[model samples]
Every structure is written in structure tokens, then in C-alpha cells.
Target: MFCTLLWGSAAPFIKWGYDLFSISQTGDILVFAGVRFLLAGLLVILAGSLLQGKLLTAGKAVMTPVLTLAFFQTFGQYFLYYLGVSQASGVDSAVITGTGAFISLLMAVYVFRYEKMTANKALGCLTGFAGILVMNASALTQAGGSLMGEGLILTSQVFSAISAAFIKKFTRTHDAVLLSGWQFACGGLALMLSGLAMGGSMPGASAAGWAVVLYLAFVSAAAYTLWGLLLKEYPLSRVGIFNCIIPVAGVFWSAALLHETGQAFAPSTLAAMALVAIGVWLVNRPETPDKRSENQTCGS
Candidate 1:
């Protein structure tokens, strides 16, 4: 819940960051994102080291996992997401982003075989997805999004799903904090270089812009580290299902911070929130003894 809320708050803050930094170009967006994640990584490493009374280390054995996560989680996901959001309608982006939980669940169930694909899980995802659509139904009625926009957003969710699986796998052996820090650092560096190569610049950013960066960095560091630990100890379905609340949180925060309060109080918004809550409950609800026994019998 805390992690999802932090992540959700990022939507409005990011918008503020772009406006404050006067960033509109793709390369500039990448550069800004790179700086944010780079700082986030350093913050995590410093704080984590202090907590454990030693520097967090990522040896050669963990380097592969770190790099793999960097590519899919940070670089691939955000790289495409920023570009996609710029091209897509806000409604379209919101709907596509909602698919993340579903995609992550699919990867956990099928790609990694980390969990069984149960009926409740499928229904939960469908219900949560419906909530997202309901919240955006007003704008969704208009049809005008490009393939580059919608397609890239969908692809970014796929990358996000892949990263979730890898995080669960790697955290079994490596320090979750170490993995989170190094992967963000490596991914940020890649984005920085790519942005530079593409002629991105942030020469005129003010103090306020930098402060927003700091906040954004903290959001990523704290949320990702905590979320990694959760994944370390719990099933992917259990942790991933909570992500359904992110969009709902986004709406509330956007209302509070951005003064988009009208929609936040609308009937559709309330209905959407209720649906999301129900979906989350369904997904995280404990399995019945009958179902467990049935599964055991089937396996036998």
C-alpha cells in the first residue's frame, strides 16, 4: 500500500518536473529520468549500507542479474513509457498502464511458473482492469491514439512484467537492496549516455526542478527497495495484486495536488475505486482448504 501510493504520487510530481525543467523533447525526458534514477540508486545504497552497518555489495555473480533487471525494469520500461505517454492520450495511457498487474501476474504464472493461475486471480485482474476503464470511460469514448503510443505502452508493461519475475528470482540469492540500487544505477547510466548521444540537455533547471528530482528519486528508492523485500518473502500474485491500487492513488493524488478534484469526486471515480478494492481483495484472499485439496488431488 505504501509502495503503491508512493509510485502513484509520481504521476503528478513527474508532470511538475517536466514543466519546471522546461523539458519537452524525448532526449531531455530521458536525461531527466536518468538523473532521477541515478540519484535514487545512490540514496538507496547509502541508506542501505548505513542500516546494515556495511556497504551493500554486488559481486560478479550478481552482476548479470543486475544488468538484466536494469535493462528490462528501468531502461526498457521507462524508456518506452515516457515516449509512449508523450504520444498517447492520457486516457489511453492510463488504461494501458493498468494492464501492468495483469501482465505481471501472467509472467509469474506462465513464464516463471512461480504460482498457479487460478480462477480468482483471473477474475480479479479482469475486475481491476474494468475499474481502470470505468474511470477513463469519459475520454475513452473518443478514439484517437497512435500505434506508436498505445503499442509502446503495452510493450513497456511487458518489460515491467519480465522485471518483476527477475526481481523475485534474484532476490532469493542476492540482497534485495543491493540489487535495487545497482540495477537503478546501471540503468540510469545507460539512459544518461543515450540521452547525451541524442543531444539532451538540462542547462537551465532551477532549484525547484532539482527538488522535484530529489523527491522523485526518493519515491523510487524507498518504494522499490521495500517492494523488493516484499517480493522476497511473498508470492508474486500477493504482492503484484496491490499494484491495482496505484491508478486509484494516482487519481486521488492528482486531485489533491494538481487540483483536478472534480473528477476525483465523480460517481465513476468512486465506482472505479470500489471495483479496484474488490479486485485486490479477491486476489489476496486466502485460498480455501477445498481448493488446496483439489489441487493436491489433481497433482497426484
Candidate 2:
């Protein structure tokens, strides 16, 4: 829940950064995101080295997972997410990101086979998705969502789901924090290179602006680290269930923090939130022994 809360802070902060730093171009946003993740990666590495009292070495197994995670989870996901936020309202972005829960659930059940999909699980995902549709229906039709906006967020979140599955598979071999740190470093480097290639230039900004950037880095490092630890301890489905709270937190934060945007949320949003909460319950609820026995019999 705490990790998800930290992540929920992202959209509003990114919007605020763009305004504060005068970031108009997509390349510029990429550069900013790159810097944030780079530092986050470094911080995690430092923490790991300190805990071990020695420099950490990256072998083939470590580098393989780190690089893969960097590309898909850190670099690919954020690239799309930042770009999507640029073209969409913060509230819309938040609501759209809520889809991550469903994506993660699907991956957990089918791809990783980490958890079996029961009737409750299926209904839970459907209910959560229904909430997402309801929450976005007004904005998508009235305010309009472009391919660049909602589409990109949708794509990135699927990558996030894939990353979760990978993390679950990899953590048994490597230290979670170290893997997280390196991935963030690799991702940041990749993003900046891409941004520069795309003609992004970093301009001088206010000290406050830099502070905001650092805060973002800090948030990424802390949130991802905590999440890495959680994945190390829990099943992907369990950790993923908490994500249902993120969009609600994000929309609330955006409405509260970035009020100048004049985003008027509808009463239906409240009902939509209720639906999502219920969905979380359904997804997270433990199955009965009888249900598991029935499932095993069916499989046999």
C-alpha cells in the first residue's frame, strides 16, 4: 500500500515538473525522466553496497535480469507513461493506470501461473475494469483521449505487468534491491540516450525545479525498492492487488495538488471508486480449501 502510494504521487509531480521546468517537448520530458531514474538507480546501488560492506559485482545472471528489467520495466514503461501523461489529463492518466491491476492479475493467473484464476478472481478483474471504464467514459468522450495519451499508458502498463512476473521469477536468485537499482540505472541511461537522439535538450531551471526532480528520483528509488522487497516476500498477485488503490490515490492527489488544471471529477467517480475497492476485495480474498480442491479435481 505504501509503495503504491508513492507511485500514485507520480502523475501530479510530472505535470508540475513540466510546468516548472518549461518542459514542452516529448524529448525534454524523456530527459527529465531519465535523470530521475538514473539517480534512483544509483541510490539503490549505494544502499546495497552499504548493507553488504563491499562493492557489488554484476555477473551474467544478474546483468541479464537487470538489463531486461531496465528495458521493459523502467525504461519502456516510464517512456510510455510520461508521454501518455503529456497528452492526457492527470486524472485521466491516473484512471488509466488503474488498469495495471487487471493486467497484473491476468499475468499472474495465466502467464506466471503464480495464482489460479477462480470465479472470484475473474469477477474481481472484470469489476475493476468496469470501474476504469466508468471513470474514463466521460473524459474519453468529452475531453478526448488520443492514441498518444491513453494508448501509450495502456501499453506501458502491460509492460509493467510483464515486469512483475519477471521479478517474481528472478528474485529467488538475485538480491531484489540490487536488481532494482541496476535496472533503474540502465533504464535511465537508455531514456536519456533516446531523448538526446530525439533532440531533447536540458535547459537551466530553478533550484526548486531541480528539487522537484530529485524528489521524483527519491520517490522512484523508495517506491521501487519497497516494491522489490514486497515481491521478494509475496506472490505477484498479492502485491499487485494493492495497485487497485493507486488510481484512486493519484486522482485524489492530482485534484488536490494540481487544482489549477480545473479537472472537475464527476459524482460517478465516487461510485467507480467503490466498485474498484470491491474488486480489490474479491481479487485478494483467499480461496476456501473446498474451492482449491474442486479446482484441482477439475484440472486432473
Candidate 3:
């Protein structure tokens, strides 16, 4: 819930950055993305070192998973999402990003064996998705942007799912903060290099640009480290369920910050939210003895 709230706050900041810097302007995307991740990576490393009294080092055993996580979650997912938001409405972007929960649930159940797929789980997921659809129905129709942008955003969710699965695997031995810092560092470096390769230059805003970069770096990145820790400590099914709240919060924040007006509590939106809430309940509810036995037997 805390992580979801923090993430929900991010849309407003990004929107502010976009409005101030014109996200689609030449080189702005690359510069903003690169700087934000790079600074976030650095800050995480510094914070981890201070807290633990030493730098967290990755060994060959953890290298593969760390790099895979960096590539997918840190770089691939955000790159696609930022680009999508740059092209589409914020509401659309929020909806598209919220799909990560469903993808993560599927991956956890089928690929990682983190959870068993049951009728209740399926219904829960469907209910949550329906809520998301309601939340974004207005923006969905307005998503007349380039299909490429939308495709990239959708594709990003796959990387997020893969990262969630891999992170769960590594949490067995590694500290979440250390792992998250390393992933951010690796991904941030990759994004910076990609920006340079694309001939993207830094934005020249005098104050606001730098402020936006700092906000993204410190708030978004550092908060995500905490989020990763929560995921490591809790069941992925449970952690992933809270993601449903992100869109709800995002819509509320967008209205509050941007003063964008629409039907804030439309009947469809309320119905969808109710379904999503029920779905989350189902997903996070304690398992019965039979379900628990099945989970243990399946080694989840």
C-alpha cells in the first residue's frame, strides 16, 4: 500500500516534468530518463553503503539475475512506459502501467510457481482488470496515439513480470536493498548509454528540469528500493495485488495536481474499483488447508 501510494505520486511529478520540459522535445526523453535512473542508482548505492557500513558487492553467482533484472525492470520497462506517457494521455499511461499486476500474477503462478492458479485467483484477476478498464475507459477511447507507443508500453509489462519472478528467486539469499541498488546502477548505466547513442542531449531548463530529474532520481528510484524489499519479504501474490491501487491513486492525483476534470466517480469506475477490491481480497486472502497443501507440494 505504501509503495502503491508512492508510485501513484510519480505520475504527477512526471506530468509536471513533461509540461515544463515538453517530453517530446528533441532529446528530452533520453536526457530525463538517463539522468533520473543514473542518479537513482547512485543514490541507492550511497544509501546502502551508509546503512550497512560497506558497499554491497555482487558476485558471479548473482550477476546473471541482477543483470537480467536491470535490463528488464529498470531499463526496458521504464523506457517503454515513459515513452508511452510522452505520446498518450496520463490516464491511458496509468491504465497501461497498472496491467503489470495481472502480468505479474500470471508469471508468478505459471512461471515461478510462486502461487497456485485457482478459480478464485482467476476471478480475482479478472475483477481487478475490469476495474482498471473502468478507471481508464475515458482515456482508452482517447488513445489515438501511435500504436508503436502503446505496443511498447504493453511490452514493458512483460519485463516487469520477468523481473518480479527473478527477484523472488534471488531474495532467498540476497538483501533486497543491495540487489535493488545494483539493478538500478546497471540499468541506469544502460539507459545513459542508450541515450548518448541515440544522440539525445540534456534539457537546458534552468531550474525546473533539474528539479524534475532530482525528484525522479531520489523519490522514484529510492522508493522503489523500499518496494523491492517489501516484495522480497512478502508473497509476490500479495505485493502484486497492491498494484491495483496505483491507478486509483494515479487518477485522484492527476485530478488534484493537474486540475484535469472528468467524472471522478462515474458508476462504471466505482463498479470497476469494487471488483478490483474484491479481486485483491481474493488474491491476498489466506489459503485454505487444501490450497496450502497444494502449494507446499508444488514447492511454491
Candidate 4:
């Protein structure tokens, strides 16, 4: 719940963060994303050390997953996502980003073999996707950003889903807190290096800009750590379904913060949220006892 809230708030704040820091180029967005994650990774480690009475630690053997996570999850995901976020409106970012959960679910089924693909999930994805399209239909023609902008944001979710699968697979023996800390740290450093190499510089932001950065750092620290823990205790679909609420909260926060009054509470936005919720429900809906019995009977 809190995890979803943290994520939901990100769309608005990210747009505002760009404005606050005057991010204008891809290099700048990368640098900014790098800074935010680097700070977040450090904070997560610090919090873990304090709460657990020791420095956050990881095993040498788990280094493979850590590196993979850093490359794919934090670094690859954020770099592209920032490009998308910068191009699209905040509301669009929020709505489109919600589709990541379904992407994760799909990956879980095919890549991880942790779940199976069913008709229900297929339909759910279509419904959710339709909602995403409705939210962005007008923008496709209005010339805010390329179709690539929305595409990149949606693609970022695939990496996010992969990250979750990594956590679920690895955290069987290791601590989620440890993995979260290391991946963020490694990924952040890598992203920062990439940004610097690409000729990106930190913008001269005001005090307010620093505040936004810090808050984003905190959000990642708390949410990623908690999300890691939650993944350990629940199946991916169960936990992932909760992520659907993010867009709703994101839209609200964007409206309130950015003062997008006319579009915030618009009919289309509400309808999109509703469709997504229903789609998520269909995705996460457990098989009924009768259905189980019927399957068993057929097998027999």
C-alpha cells in the first residue's frame, strides 16, 4: 500500500523535478536520474544498517544477480524512462507507467516460469492497454513528444518487471534489503558514469530542487526496500496487482502539484483508472475452488 503510494507520487514529482532543475536534454535527464538513484541507494543501505544493527551486506556469490539487476533494473530502466517522462506530460507518464505490472506478469509467466498464461490474463492486459491508449490518444496527434516517448516509458516497465523477478528468485536465500541496496548503488554509479561520459552536467538548481531530489531519494529507498520484502512474502501477481493504484495516485498528485485542473479530473482519466483497476483485478483474481476441482477432475 505505502509502496504503491510512493510510486504513485513519482510521476508528478519527476515532472516537477525536471522543471525545477531545468532538465532539457537526454544527457541531463540521465545525470539527474543517476543522482537520484545514487542518493537513494546510499540511503537504503544506511537505513538497513541502522535498523538491522549492522552495515548492509551481500554475498560474493549473489554478485551475478546484483550486476544483472543494476544493469537491467535500475540503470537501463531509469535511463530510458527519464527520456519518456521528459517528453510526455505527467499525467501521461502516470497512466502509461501502470502497464508495467502487466508486463512483469507476462515476463513472470514466460521467462521465469513462475506463473502460467491464461485467457483471463491476456484479456486483462488488453483492457489495461486500452486504458493506456485512451489516456494518450489526444497526445499522439498534439505533438508533445514522439511516439517513442510513450514507448520508452512503457518499455521501462519491462525492465522493472524483470527486476522484480530477479528479487523473487534471489531473495530466497539473501536479504531483500541487501539486494536493494547493492543494486541501487551499483546501478547508480554506473548510470552516473554514463551520464558524465555523455557530457551531462548537474544543473544549478535552487534549494527547492535539492529538496525534490532528496524526497525522490527517500521514496526509492523506502519503496524499493519494502517492495523487495513484500516480494519475498507474496506471489508476484498478488503484490504486483497493488501497483495498479499507482496511476490513480500519480494522476491526482500531478493534477494537484502541476495545477492541471481541467485534465486532472477529466472523464477520460477517471475512466482509464477504472478500466485499469478492473483489468488488474482480473489479472490477480485467484482461481475459485470449483475451478480447481474441475481442473483436477479433468486431469483424473
Candidate 5:
């Protein structure tokens, strides 16, 4: 829940950062994101090492997973997301990206075979998605979602889901925080290079702009490190369902911080929150003994 809230603040903060830094071009956005993640990676490594009482070095054993995550999680996901958001409506982007948890569930159950596809998981995902729809009901009625825009956003979600599954798998053998930090470092570098290659440059930087970058970096560092630990110990569904809370938190922070409070406390927003909370509960609810027994039998 805390991690999701941190992530939710990101959209509004990124917008603010762009304005403060005078960022308008796609290349500049990529460079900004790259810098944030690079700083975040360093913070995680430094803090995680201090906490663990040793240096968090990436050995050859961990390099494969680190690079894999760097590609899917950091560089690929954010690259597509920035591009997609530029072309898509904010409502469309939110609604589409909200499917990330649902995608993670499906991939975990089928592709990874890490868990069974239970009725509870399926229903919970659907319910959460419906809440997202209701929450964005006003803007959704405006009919502006294009193929390129929505398509790229959905693709970015796929990368995110894949990264989650791989994190769960990798953490079984490697240190979760170590993997996260190094992967972030690698991916951030990649994004920086890509942005620079595309003629991106940050011409102006203020103390406030730098502060925003630092805060955003901390958000990613802390949230992802803790989230990696959670995935290490729990089923993907158990942790992933909380993703629905992100958009809700984003709306709240956007309202309070960005002063887009028109519908912050509206009935629709409150109702949507209720639906999302219920969906999270349903997903994390313990399975009945009978259901577990049936699953075991089916496995045989």
C-alpha cells in the first residue's frame, strides 16, 4: 500500500518537474526519467548496503537477471510509457496502465506457472478494472483513444508484468535489493544514452527542479526495493492486486498537490475507491480448504 502510494505521487510530481525544468520534448522527458532512475539506483545501492552490513555488488551470477530487469522494468517500460502518454489522453493512459496488475496475474498463472488461476483472482482483477473505469467515467466518455497511444501504453504494461514475474523468479536465488539496484543502474544508463542519442538535453535546472528529481528518485528506490522484498515472500497476486490503488492514489495526490480537485471527493471517486479496496481484499483472501484440496487434486 505504501509503495503504491509512492508510485501514485509520481505522475503529478513528474508533471511538476517537467514544468519547473521547462521540459516539453519527448527526448527531454526521457533524459529526465533517466536521471531520476540513475539517482534512485545509486540511493538504493548505498542504503541497501548499509542496511545489509556489506557492499551490494552485482556478481556474474546476478548479472543476467539484473540486465533482464534493467531492460524490461526500467528502460523499456518507461521508454514506452513516456512515448505513449505523449500521444494518449491522460484518462486513457490511466485506465490502460491500470491493467498492469491483471496482466501480472495472468502471466503468473499461465506463463510462469507460479500460481493457479483461481476464481477469486479473476473476479478481483475484473472488479478492480471496473472501478478504474468508473473513476475515469467522465473523461472516458470523451472518445479519443487511438491505436498508437493506447497500444503503446498496453505494451508498456506488458513489460511491467514481465518484470514482476522475473523479479519473483530471480529473488528465489539472488538478493532482491541487489537485483533491483543494479538493474536500475543499468537501465537508467541505457535510458540516458537513448535520450542523448535522440538529441535530448536539459538546458535549465533549478534547485527546485533538482529537488523534484531527488524526491522522484527516492520514490522509485524505496518503493521498488520494498516491493521486491514483498514479491520475494508472497504470491504475485497477493502483492500485485495492490496496483489498483495506484491510480486512485494518483488522483488524490493530483487533486491535493496539483489542485485538480474538481472531483477529488465526488461520489464516483469514493465509490471507485470502495470497489478497489474490495477487489484487493478478494484477491488476498485466504483460499478455503476445499479450494486448496481441489487445486492439489487437479495438479495430480
Candidate 6:
């Protein structure tokens, strides 16, 4: 939960970092995305080696899936997120990213069949999305950014959902830390190569810019590793419920950092948040015997 809160705070900080560095000056969006991921990946690898003694070695059989997971989660998802943040406000970006839980639930039900959508879950999903709408309503008036960029952020959420499902598939056999390190390494390498291809260069970066990069590398990457470990140990349904706290934390952080003023909180936002919180609690609480039996029968 603490890691998630920290990760949530990263959006505004990353936006500030991009502003300080002007990452676009190097070349293109891909370059900017690549550099951040590459640096982060290297740090994770180093951390894994120092903390765990050695990295996990996968057989040729599992290498492809791991790479694919990395590509979706680290490369595709974050590349789009960075581009979106560059185009939009941190608050906007954070809320959109928070929508990933809803997308993940949909994917889990329809595609993976790992979970069913009960009434409570449906209510929770709707309430959570309503909260996002309430938050973004004010920003809707001033439309300076490209819709494409916003769409990209939403698309990244889908990729994240897919990656979550994929990661769950292999967690039983893999060491989460080693798996996370490899994913970061591969994803970071992919980003760096893309950056080089686009003629990206990191010159004249301010101390603040470097600080942001370090935070992203060490804290974000390390926290993500811990998250992977948690996911492996817990049920996805239960683990995912904690993600709801992220946006609430993000909104408060944005208000503090951006010095946002006079934004009236609508009753709907509170109501939506309340409903979602209740839904998460209900969904994750220990199921009654009848519910468990039903689930087992359904599986059979």
C-alpha cells in the first residue's frame, strides 16, 4: 500500500522532471520514453544482484513470455504514459492511469476467465469510473491538449491489464524480484535502443531532472518489484482492491505540488469514492462458504 501511494505520487514529479529537462528536445517521444526506462531497468538489475546475490535464469521456454510481459508493461504502457503526461496535466494523467483497475477487471472476466463480475464488482467499477469523470469534469472546459495523447494513456491501461494477467500466469514458478528485474532490463534496453535510433541525447539536464530520473529508477522500479511479489502471494481480486487508494493519494499530491486552488469538490466525487471503497471491501473480504462453493462448482 505504501509503495502504491509512492507510485501514485510519481506522476506529478515526473511531469515536473520533464518540464525541467525538456525531454522532447533530444529527439522524439520514443527517445524520452526509452531513456527513462533504460535507466530504471539498469537500476533494478543492480538492486536485484546486490539484494538477491544473483538474478534468476530462465530456460529458453519462458524467455519469450517474460520479454512479452516486459514489452507490454514496461515499454508499451509507460512509453504511452510519458507521452500522455507531456501532453496533459498531471492530475489528468493520474486519474486516467487510475482507471487501469477497471480495465483489468474487464480483461480478467472476459478474456482470462480468472474472475467473475458479481453485482458488487460491477457497482464498484461504475462508481470508480464516475469518480474519474467527476475529477476530470473541470478540466474538460479547457482543451489545449491533443485527444490522441489522452487516448494513448487509456490504451496504456489496457496494456497494463494484459501484462498483469501474464505476470500472474508465471508467478508460481518464478522469483518475482528476478522476473521484475529482467522485465525492467529488457524494457529499458528496448527504450534506449529506440532513443538512439531517434537521435536522442541527454545533455544539459538540471540536477532536478536527474533527481526525478533517480526517483523513477530506484523508487518506482523497486516498488514495482515489491508489487509483483505481493501479486504472486495474494489473490488478484484482493491485491487489486488496494489500487483504489492510488488516485485519492494522487489527487492530494497534485493539489499540493501544483498549488491548485478553488477546485470545488462535488458531492458526486465523494459519493463515487465511497461506493467504490465499499465495493472493494466487499469484493475482497473472505467469501462465505456458499460463494466459495459456487465458485468451485463453476470451475468444475
TM-score head-to-head 2 vs 6, winner: 2
- Per-candidate clashes, comma-separated: 0, 0, 0, 0, 0, 1
* Least well predicted 10-residue stretch by lDDT in candidate 1: 87-96
Model 4 alpha-carbon drift over 4 Å, by segment:
141-145, 290-300
Global Cα lDDT for candidate 3:
0.73
Provide the overall lDDT of each model, using Cα atoms, as 2-decimal numbers.
Answer: 0.81, 0.83, 0.73, 0.84, 0.82, 0.70
lDDT of 5 at 96: 59
| Model 2 C-alpha lDDT per residue in residues 131-201, reported as the tens digit of each score | 87776676567654445687889899999999988988888778888898889999999998888888986
In candidate 1 the C-alpha lDDT for residue 234 amounts to 81
- How do all the candidates rank in terms of lDDT, highest first? 4, 2, 5, 1, 3, 6
Question: How much is 230 displaced in model 4, in angstroms?
Answer: 0.9
Total colliding residue pairs, candidate 1: 0
Worst 10 residues of 4 by lDDT: 291-300
Give Cα distance to truth, residue 185, candidate 6, Å.
1.4
Q: Candidate 5 clashing pairs?
A: none
Off by over 4 Å in 5: 85-97, 135-151, 263-272, 293-300
lDDT of 6 by residue, 133-221 (tens): 66556556666634665677788888988888777777778767767777877887787677677787665488877877777777657
TM-score of 3: 0.88
RMSD vs true structure, all candidates: 2.8, 2.5, 2.6, 2.7, 2.8, 2.9
Question: Of 4 and 6, which scores higher on TM-score?
Answer: 4
lDDT (Cα, tens digit) per residue for candidate 3, span 172-256: 7887777788888788777777777877766556587778778778875667787788777777876787777776787677677
- TM-scores of the models, in the order given: 0.89, 0.93, 0.88, 0.93, 0.88, 0.86
Better candidate by lDDT, 1 or 3: 1
Model 1 per-residue lDDT at 221: 97
Model 1 lDDT, residue 237, Cα: 73
